[model samples]
Target chain A: MSPLSTLTPRTLKKPSPARSRLRGGARYAPTLATVGLFLAMFAVGAGMYPSFLSGQVFLNLFIDNTFLIVLAVGMTFVILTGGIDLSVGAVVALSMMVSATLLQQGWNAGAVIVLVLLIGGGLGLLMGLIIQYFDIQPFIVTLAGMFLARGLCYVISLDSIPVTEGFFTGMAQAQIPLSGDLFVSPGVLLALGIVAIAFFVLHHTRFGRTVYAIGGNEHSAMLMGLPVKSTKILVYALSGLCSAVAGILFSFYSLSGYSLAAQGMELDAIAAVVIGGTLLTGGTGYVLGSVVGVLVLGIVQTFIAYDGTLSSWWTKIVIGGLLLVFILLQRLFARKAG
Target chain B: MKSLLKHRLAWPVIALAALLLLNQIFRPDFLGLRMQDGHLYGSLIDIMRNGAPTILIALGMTLVIATRGIDLSVGAVVAIAGAASCAYIAASPDPGSPVTAATAVLIAVVAGLALGVWNGFLVSTIGVQPIIATLVLMTAGRGVAQLITGGQIISVSNDHYKSIGAGYLFTLPISILITAAVFALAAVLTRRTALGTLIEAVGINPVASRLAGLRARNIIWIVYIFSAVCAAIAGLMISSNVTAADANNAGLYIEMDAILAVVIGGTSLAGGRYTLVGTVVGAFIIQTLTTTVYTLGIPPEVTLVFKALVVITVCLLQAPKARNLLNRLKAAPKPAAKEAAKEKVAI
Candidate 1:
C-alpha cells in the first residue's frame, strides 16, 4: 500500500456521539439566536413603546423593511458558501433601473419583472463564471462586479425615474386586509415567500449540503466528488435573483429607481447576516438568522429615530460594535472546532 | 535574447503597448512627452505623482500579504494619522510653530504604530481572521480620527508641513521621493534579513512553519506595524499638500485602490509570494489609467467601469488556471479536427 493509504488508515474514524451532538447544537445556534433575538425585540418594544406591539406597526415594518430582509436572505446563501457578494446592492440599483426604464416605455409589470430578474441573474452568472473558471478571489471579483453593475446603472439613468405604470402603482399601493385597521403590502408577502423558500432549500436539500461541504473545505469536497464549481455558480445566480426581487420591493416604498439606489446597503446586509450569527468565513448560518438580523438593525434605527439628538452616523458605530462582537464569537468557535 | 523576450514581464509590456495604441486611436496627443521650465512635465508625471500614495500603501501591503494576511484598516489609519498631524499643528501652543510640525509628525507616526499593534493583537492573539479583525479598526479608526479633529477640517499654514507634500527635489516631486525611499527601505530590509523567508514560510503554511519553530505571531505583528507606518507617511503627504485635514474623506476608498494596485502588480491576496517592484508598476498603471480617463475626455463617472474592466482582464491573465484552460481550449480542437478529416479521407 502507498504511504498515503497507511496514513489514512490511521486517521479514518467516525466522530463520537458527544462530538456529533455538539456539532448539531452548533448548527442550530444561529437559528435559535435569531428567534430569541426577535422575541426579545418584541418584548422590549412592547414594554417600552406599547404602540410598537400593534399589528399596524408590524405591517409598517414589513412595508418599509422587507427589501433589507430579502437582501439578507440572499446574502446568507452566498456567505454559507464562504463567498461574499458585494455586488448585490449595485445589482439592486441595476435591477431597479431596468424596471423603471421598462415601465417608462409602457411595458407590463410581469414582463418588466422577468426582464430585471434575468438581467440580474445573467450578471451574476457572468461574475460566477469569472470566479470559478479563473480561480480569482471572490472578494475582488465581487468588488469588480459592484463597480460594473453600478456603472451600468449610471449608463441607464443618472437621476431617479418615478414609476408611472399602472401595475407597479397598484401593487405598490395595495394593502393587505387585517382586523382593526392593520395592513401590509404585497411586497411584504413576497419577501416572506422568498425567505421561506430559502430556508427550506438551505435546510432540506442535497445542494445545501454540497454548499456547506464546499465552504468547509473545497479541496476535500472536490476529493469527495462534489460538483463544487457548478453549485457555487448556482448560489450566486440565486443571490442575484433575490437581489432583483428586493429591488422591486424597494421600488414599492421609494417609488423610484436611480443609479444611487441602495448606496452603502451591502454593508447593511453584511451587518444583518453577522448580527444574526452567520460566520463571514462560511460553512455555517441560517436564513432566519439573517431575517432577525434585519429586524434588529431596523429596530435599532427606529430607536435612534425616537431619539432626535443622535446623528445617523451613530448607527454605523453601533453596527461596527456588533460586527466586532460577532467576529470575536466566530473566532472563538473556529478555535474550538479546530 | 529570445528567452529574455519571453519573460512574464513581456505581457505587461504588451498590455502597456496596447493601452498606448488605444489612447493614440482615441486621443491623438496622449503619448506626448515634453519638457517645461527645466522640469519633465507630462500626463505621465502627473499619474506618477498622484499614484505615489497607492504605491506607498502597496509597498506596506506587500509585507502584510506576504505573511498570508490582509490589512483593510490602512485607509482609516491614514485618516487618523492625517487628523492627528493636522490637529497637533493647528492646536499648537504657538500658531505655525516649528515644534508643531515635529510634534505632529511624531504623534501621527506613534498613533499609526499603536493602531497597527492593536490590529496585530486581534489577529495574532485573538485568532481573528485578518480581514475581519482589521475591518473593526477600519470602521472605528476613521471615527476616532474624526472625534480627535472635533469633526472639522483643521488647516495648517506651517511651511515645514506644506513642504512634506509640495516640495520638489531636482525636478522630482517629494511624494515620489517619499514613495521611493519607503519602498527602497522595505526592499532592502526584507532582502537583507531572514524576515522575507520567515514571512513566506508562515504564509504558505502557518501550522507547519509554527511546528518548525518560527514565531509566526511576531512576524504578523511587525508587518502590520510596518503597514501603519507606511500609511502614516502617505497621510502626511496628503495633509501637507492640501494644507488641511478633512477626516471624513481624507483616505476614502484608498484601501480598495491599494488592494487593486497590489493585485495588479501580481501579488496574490491569498498570500505566500510578494513583489515590491510589481506593486510599484501596479500603482503606475492605476495612476496612468486615472490620468488617461481625464485626458481622453471620459466622464469621471465612467472611470469605475474602465477600472473594473482592466482588473478583470489583468486577473484573468494572471490566473494560471485560466491561462492553462485557454491554452487547452486552443490546442484541444486541433487534434479532434485532424482525426475527423483523416477519417473522412480514409472513407
Candidate 2:
C-alpha cells in the first residue's frame, strides 16, 4: 500500500496531450464524419430549397422518423453486442397488428401496448436463448423470428385495422410545443426520451460496459468473468422491447396497422446504425451516434421530398451509395485500429 | 436399413417423399405425368421447372456459402438482369428475333457480372463483411432495376426469349435443362478440380489458409462472381418464362428460399463442408413444400410460419445441445444397468 501510494500521482501521469488527441480523433472520426455529412447535406438542401431550413422542417425530421429512431436505438444495443436482430421490422409489424386488433376489440390501449411489448420481447428472448444454448447463428435465428412475426401478422388479419382507440389518436395528434412556435409530435418526444435513456444506459451502466466487453471479444469477456450470456440475452430483449415501442409509435403515426407495414424497415434501421459509425463487427458505437444516424436518414428523405422532381427510387440508390461510402470509411478506420 | 437411416441424404429424400405422398393422398393426379406436344406436363415437372430459378441460384449460393460468405444481392441481381434484358428486348426493333433475345441475354449476363465484380471487390479486397457488402446491392439494386425498366413491367413475347425459360427441348423443359447444365458445370468445376477444396479451406479458416499461401481473397472474389452469374441466369429463366420483367417482384424473397434450401440440405450456416446433391434435394423439398401448402389450402401466406418451424426443427436436430438433450431423453427411459453399460463403453 505504501509503495502504491508513493508511485501513484507521479508515475500515473496522464498520457501526452498530443497522443491523447490522436487517440480521441481516431475514436470519434466516423461519428464526426457522419455529423459533417449530415450537416453538409442539410446545407445543400437549405441552399436548394427555400423552406428547408425552418425550425418546423428540422423538427419534422424527428417527427416523421420517430419510429425509425426507436428501431435504430434498439438495433444499436443489439449490434453493440456483436449480434443482429433481423426480426425488428417484423416484430414492429406484429406489435402493430396485435395492438390494432386488441384496440378494435375495445381493449384498453395501455393493456394492448403491454401485451404487444411482451410478445415482441418474448420472441427476442426465445431467439436469444436458442442462440445461446443451441449455438445457432444470430442471423439465422432472427431470420426465422422475422418469418414467424410476419406470418403472425397475416394471421391477425389480412387488412389494415384502423386505430379507433382514443389514446392512440390523441397521442398521434398531440404536439409538444417548443420555443419560437416550433413543435414536435408526442411520438417524437417519446423517441427522444428513449434515446436519452439509451445514451445513459450505454455510457454509464455496468450492463452497458459488459455489452461492450462482450462485443469486443466474447471469449476474453468470459475469461474476465463478465456475464456474457445474460448480457447477450438482455441486449436482444432490449432490442425487441424497443422495436415494440417503435411499432406503437408507427401505429400512432399512421393511425392504422397493416400486415405489410414496415416492410424492409429492418434494413433501414441497420443502415442507420451503420451510418452512425457503429462497426458491424460490434463494439465502438454510441446511442447518440445512432440518433444522428436516424437524423441523417430523415434529412435525406426531407431533401428528396423538397426536390419534388426527383423520384422516390432515388432515395434508395442514394442510401445504398451512402452505405457503401460509410462502410468503406469504417473498414479504413478498423484497419487503422487493428 | 440403419445405414440408410444414417445416410446424409436420407432425411431430405424422406421429406420430399412425404410431401409427394401427402399430395398424392389429397389428389391422385399430383404425381401423374402426361406428354403433350412431346413435352412432359405434370406436377413433378412443374416443381422442377418452377424451382429451377431457385435451384440455379442455390447452386451459386452453395459455393458462396462454402467460402463462408453470403450474397444477399443475388435476388437484386436477378431483378436487375431481368430488367436489363427485358428493357433491351422491349426497345429492340426486332424483339421477336432470336438475335435480339441473344443480345438481351448478353446484356443481362454482363450486368450481372459487373454487379458481381462490385460485390466481390468490396468483400474480398476491402475486407467488408460479406453480408454488409451484399446488403448494399440488395437495398439499391431494385431501384436500379426499376430505373432500367422505367418502373414498368416489360413484357416480351419473343419465342427465343420465352424458350430460354419455358420452352421445351427433347421432351424436357428448357429451364430445367439450363439448371441441369449449370449444376453439372458447378459439379465438374468443384469436384473435378481442386477449386472446391481451396474454397472450403478458405471458408474453414481464412487466416490459416492465407498463411498457408492460399489466395482466400481471390477465391472469395471468384465465388461471388460465380454466384452473381448464376443469379443472372436464374433471372433470365424467371422473366423469360413469365414473358415479363417485374423489377419489383422478380426474385423477391428467393434468397430466403435458397438459404433455407442450403440449410435444409445439411449445409452449415457457419460455413465449410457443402454438398450439391443435398442442395438439389433441398430445393425439391422446398418446391414440394410450397406445392403441398397450396394443396392443403391453409392460406398461402401461412407457409412462412411453416417454413420458420422447419428451419428451427432442422437446426435443432443439427445443434449439439439439442442432440445431447435428445440423447439424455432417450437414456432416461432406459434402466440404470443400460446407462452404466453405455458409460462403460464410452469410457
Candidate 3:
C-alpha cells in the first residue's frame, strides 16, 4: 500500500468524545469572550457614570440599538454560512425609500410595509441565485447588489420623505412603560422579537445545522447530501427580510426615509457580528452573541456622549479596535483547536 | 483573425473605442486638440488627466488581485494619506516652499507604508481574511484621518504642491505622466524580474508554492504594501488638485472603481493572470463613462445607476456560464450529432 493510504486511514478515524467536546467548547469561546467583554464595558460605564446603572439606561441600549440589532441578527445568519451580504445597508435604504414614497402617495402603511419586505426579499433572492449558480464570489455579487439597490433608491427619490400618517406616527410614538422612568418602544420590542426568533431558528433547526456544516466544509457538506444551494439562498433571503424589518424600524425611529439613510450600516452590522464572537470565516457564532455585540456598540456610543469632551468618531475607532482584538482571539482559538 | 478577436484585451479596447466614438458623435470637437500655451487641450487629454488616479490605483490592484488577495483599505488609506500630507502642509511655517511640500509628500507615503505593513502583518502573519483584515483599517483609518485633520478640511496654498495634481509637465498633465511612469515601472519590475511568475504561482496554489520553496508570505506582504503606496500617491494627486483635504469624502468609493477597472480589463478577481495594458484601457473606459454621463446631461444622482448597469453587463458577459450559453445559442441549427459530441467533450 502507498504511504498516503496508511496515513489517510489513521487520520480519518473518529476523534475521541472528550476531544470532540473540547473542540466544541473551543468553538464557543469567542462568543463567550464577547459576552464577557460586553459585561466589562457595561460595568466600566456604570462606574464612570452612576446614571448609567439605572434600568432606564439599560432600556435605552435596546432602544438605541434596535435597528442595529436587527441588522446584526440578519448578518449573523449570512456570515454563519460563510457568505456575506454587503447590500444589507443599501437594501435598508431602498426599503426605507420605497415605503416612504408609497406612504407619501397616501398608500396604506401596512400594504407599503409588506411591499417593501417583498422587494427586499426578491432582491436578496436574485443576488443569492447569481452567487450560487454562477460561481461568483459573494463579495462581488453583493457589492453589485449594493450598487443596484442604492441606485434604485436614488431613482425612487433623491430627497427624504417624511411619514406623517397616523399608522407610522402611532407606531413611532407607542411605548410600553417598563418602570417608573423607563419605557420600551414598539421598535425595541420588534427587534427583541427578531433576536428571539433568530436564536430559535439558528440553534434549534436542521437548516441552521446545515448552514454550519456548509461553512465548515462545503465539499464535505455536499458529500453528506446536505441541501447546500437552498440553504445558501435561504440565508441571504433571511438577511434581506431582516434588513427590511430594520429599515421599517428605522423609519419609525427617524420618521423619515432618505436615500442615503443607513449608509455604511452593513459594515456596522458586520462589525457587530464579529465583535459578538461570530468568526469571519464562519461556522461558529451565536444569535444572542450578536445582540450583545449590538449592545456593546450602543453602550460605547452612549458612553462617548456622556463623556461630552470626546469625539463621537471615537465610537468607530473603538469598534475597529474591538474587531481587531476579536479577530485575533478567533485566530488563537482556531490554532488551539487545530 | 479569430485569435486576435480572442485576445483578453480585445473587449475592453473595443469598449473604450466605442465610448470615444459615442463622444465624438455627440461633440464634433471631442478629438480636437489645440495648444493652449504649451499644454494640450481636448476631451482626450481630459480623459487621461482625470483617469490618472484610477489608473494608479488599478495598477496596484491588478497585482494584488493577481495574488488571490484584495486591498479594500486603499480608499481609507487615500483619505489618511491626503489628511496627513495636507495637515503637514497646512501647519508648516513655509507651506509654499518646495522643501515643505516634499516633506509633506514623504510623510504621506510613509504613512501609506506603515498602513501597508499593518495590513500585511494581519493577513500574512496572523491569517485574517483579507476582507475582514482590510476592513479593520477601512473602518478606523477614516477616524485617524479625522484626528489628524482636527475634524476639518485642511486647505493649502502652495504652487509646488498644486502642480503635482493640476499642473502640466512638458505639455502633458503631470498626473498623466506620473501614471505612465508608474505603469512602466511596474511592467518592468514584474515582467523583467521573477516577481510576476512567483505571484501567479502563489495565487494559483499557495500550498504548492510553499512546498516548492517560494516565500509566499513575503510575496503576499509586499503586494499589500505596494498597493497602499500606490493609493497614497493617488491620494496626494487628489488633494493637490483640489488644494484641500476633505477627510470624509476623499477617495470615497475609489476602491470599487479600481476593482471595476481591473475586472473590466479582463483580470479575474479569482486571482492569477493579469494585464497592465488592459488595466490602463479599463481605467480610461471608466473615466470616459463618467464624462459621457455629464455630456449626456444625465443627472449626477443617477450616474451610479448607469455605472452599475455597465458593471453588471460586463460581469455577466464574462461569466463562464453566460459565455457557454451564448456559444450554445450560436451553435444551434448546426448538426445535432456534432453538437452532442461538443457537449460531451465539454463535460
The DockQ values of the predictions, listed in order, are 0.45, 0.76, 0.60
Q: Determine the backbone clash count of candidate 2.
A: 0
Instruction: Please list the residue runs of candidate 3 whose C-alpha ends up more than 4 Å from where it truly belongs after superposition.
Output: A1-17, B336-347
Clashes of each: 0, 0, 0
Candidate that scores best on DockQ: 2
Write down the TM-score of every candidate: 0.88, 0.96, 0.95
Cα lDDT of model 2 by residue, B76-175, tens digit: 9999999999999999898899899999999999998999999999999998999999999999999899888888899988999999998999999999
Docking class of 3: medium
Residue A34 of model 2, lDDT score: 96
lDDT of 1 by residue, B13-52 (tens): 5665666677677877667777766666766667777887
* Clash pairs, model 1 backbone: none
Number of the top lDDT candidate: 2
C-alpha lDDT of residue A184 in model 2: 91
By the lDDT metric, which is better: model 1 or model 2? 2
A-chain TM-score of every model: 0.90, 0.95, 0.94
Model 3: chain B TM-score vs. truth? Answer: 0.96
Candidate 1 docking quality: incorrect, acceptable, medium or high: acceptable
TM-score of chain A of 3: 0.94
Kindly list the per-residue Cα lDDT of model 1 for residues A189-277, writing each as its tens digit: 89999889988888788788888888788889989889998999988888888788889888877778899889768878988898788
Where is model 2 chain A poorest over a 10-residue stretch in terms of lDDT? A8-17
